[model samples]
Target: MMSDCGLDYIELLQQEVDRTSAKLLYLRNEEEPEEAPPPRHTPHTCSAPRRLAISPGLGGKPLTPPFTENLRRLLFGRTVRVFNFDWRKSFFHFREPNSELSYALQVDQGGARAVQMVIQARIIKHLLFSQQGGSEGRSLLSLTELGPPEQQGALAAALSDSLWLAGQEESATVTMVTEDDSPKPPSEYRLDLLTEKMHTFVFNRKEELSSFLLDHIHCFQEEGGHGVVLFLYSLVCSRTIDRIREDLDSSTAHLLQRRLGNFVCSQALLNLLLTGRATPHVCNGTQAPGGGAAPLDPPLQGVLSRGDIGYLHWSREQMDRDRLLQVGSMLKTPRFPVWLCCINSTYSVLFSLTRSLLSDWRTEHQFQLFYYNGQNSQNSTARLTIDTHSHHWEAPSVDPGVDLEKRFPSLEMTIRTKWEGASINWGGIPPFY
Candidate 1:
């Protein structure tokens, strides 16, 4: 009954609605798949960003300029392998590009002194002087063979100290080996005279010690020599001072006492022991060939005015170049008993490790002193470690001597074959265990 146009319009509208519904269903089907899984938390199984670091690599910040420059000079162009000690983990971590050239040098935080001294003195000396006189100079020179006996003696002393610091005491040996293939002359290094007990005088009270030395002041003087300095060194090493008194004779001691000066080597040595720095200069009644004492604004005490201390292994230019070394603090006094003593940077001396210098007087009474004769002589190779707490030379039951081979054979061989005069090892392979 409806009109033809009206009925057709209604039908068209219905068709359009049906078509639109079909197109929407097709589009929905194309957009999403039925097999897709739902999203989940699962935080434990997933990876997250790492904590940001202050430095580029896992290793912490870079070494300071002074340390870097030192490494650079010591290793030259060699690749530097860094070994960081993680106190937290109680282990060492190493880093490098290639395992082969990565670590040619090893530097620890606390033990840099040993490496530093060796590089500055031994390696540097060989590099600069080994080629002299057109003969390939031996890298290792005995104390006896070197000239300027005083200078050689000092260097030998430093080497000996380094050995002890490395804990190579009993492992080290003195042999008849020479730089050249020449006949092994009588072994300069001897160990027979060593005794178990060191004749050391321990004074808990400084004033008492001062009084005693002052009373026997004449026993320290020498003709044209710094006998007081030597005496103090001997005392620190726990050498038999009574024997020295005997050797000098009573008449000489009396004459020396009468001729003693207000400022003597003893005072300088005492200052070194007390303050860890020698203030007075030792005067031998002789003027320098060229000039007077270096004009220090603050002024220093003692006899010799010029800087009497010089490292034969270190040139003035080299010393000035290294800023960290320029300051005398590097050689500052360590805690008591553990002394980093130097004889004008010419010789090295060390006190006992068995007792700390700061130990309570009530608990422990003595310490040990170690002395290495680095002079270029048959006896230059000998090392004397004395138990300073005991005043007696011969303790009947005590074992005074420590056999390096028996105690630390591996360490001794390593030192002899590897580290004796070799350059610093960056690989951290030098048995610091």
Candidate 2:
């Protein structure tokens, strides 16, 4: 037994050493490859030949950054402990309520604003769960739940009143009242009674509650941006549901229902903002152009005005072409268009997503109001053709004799990258419920 244990320990140590060595090599730039020039191809008269050069260094390579180290540190570092709650349930529960809030905001806004409007709503509620140490199965703890549509008219009234009262001292008062109102407070309010109860529960400890709430609020604000706030809320709710089930054997179907509701509400709000109508509130709302309300949403309408719908339309086209190319590449078939389209779409999507997410209000206004309508006098076009005559290649037989484990070693690598990116993106946002 002793010898076996010793062997296991040695193996573990060796593994750690290998991992560290690999990471150090990467950090020191020893694992990166040099760049190469593009292959010669038939070029269109209006465009330069497309280059197929590899990037020069580690950072130059797209989607190949060293994320493991960052992830490891984030996971192991000291983290703020927010109470685990079922996300899906919270989402579904809040969906209708938030949708109502959105409807109210629209009615209150009254279709007169020159600029786009945004209304943020938050609510808190109590939750109950099992506590193994205190009871046979569980117990109840007073916690806070943040969501929208605390009541029917409260959110809309607050948002509308705030908008109308902007640029005045009353705006701050309105904001505070909206943020601090107890959505479902008990009928009776006795400050002295609550104070005495709080004193009695001193032994239970409560300092962490304030800190956790602060942390959550800070994280939420920091993650605020176009679509980020909604996305973060969704992520938190999903993760909470997952954590609860895995850790507590809790049934999360109810939670999932709630999460769906929240998602619907968010979608409805987004739709309302985009389109000038409340069609998104309908259960069978149409999303396609011309089928639903004219012009769809504001952002999309803005895109159309600029004639840059080509950006997104081109992206979708490229994605389809890339999918076909990947299959062709695997089958060793002719894949010139597929490969080119895949690379081009990948670059374009990267640029567009980044720009859309990071561009500020000023930049967006400038683009939409001025540059979008202007004509590009110096229009240019380019094309390229792959010359595979000199390249020797043979298609492998369709027999299932290939060693997939060795041939597709990078499959796991690709999956890990995608998962890591998603996690990082979601991590910055606030929890839904």
Best by lDDT: 1
TM-score of each: 0.18, 0.17
* Residue ranges of candidate 1 with Cα displaced over 4 Å: 1-56, 59-333, 341-349, 356-367, 371-433
Task: Encode model 2's per-residue lDDT on 1-433: one tens digit a residue.
Answer: 5797898787556545534443343233222222322122121111000111111221111111122122111221211111011110111111223231221112111111111122221111001111123212221111112144233223333222222222121211111101111222122211110011100000011233223222222222221111122222222222232332232111111211112111112222222222222122222222233334356332111111111111111222334354311211111111110100112212111111112312243332211100010012212111111122222112343556763222221212122121221111112322111
What TM value does model 2 have?
Answer: 0.17
Model 1 Cα lDDT, one tens digit per residue, 203-228: 33334443433333222211111122
Candidate 1 local Cα displacement, residue 33, angstroms: 81
Q: Model 2 Cα displacement at 57 (Å)?
A: 54
Instruction: State residue 285's C-alpha deviation in candidate 2, in Å.
Output: 10
The deviation in Å at residue 409 for candidate 2 is 17
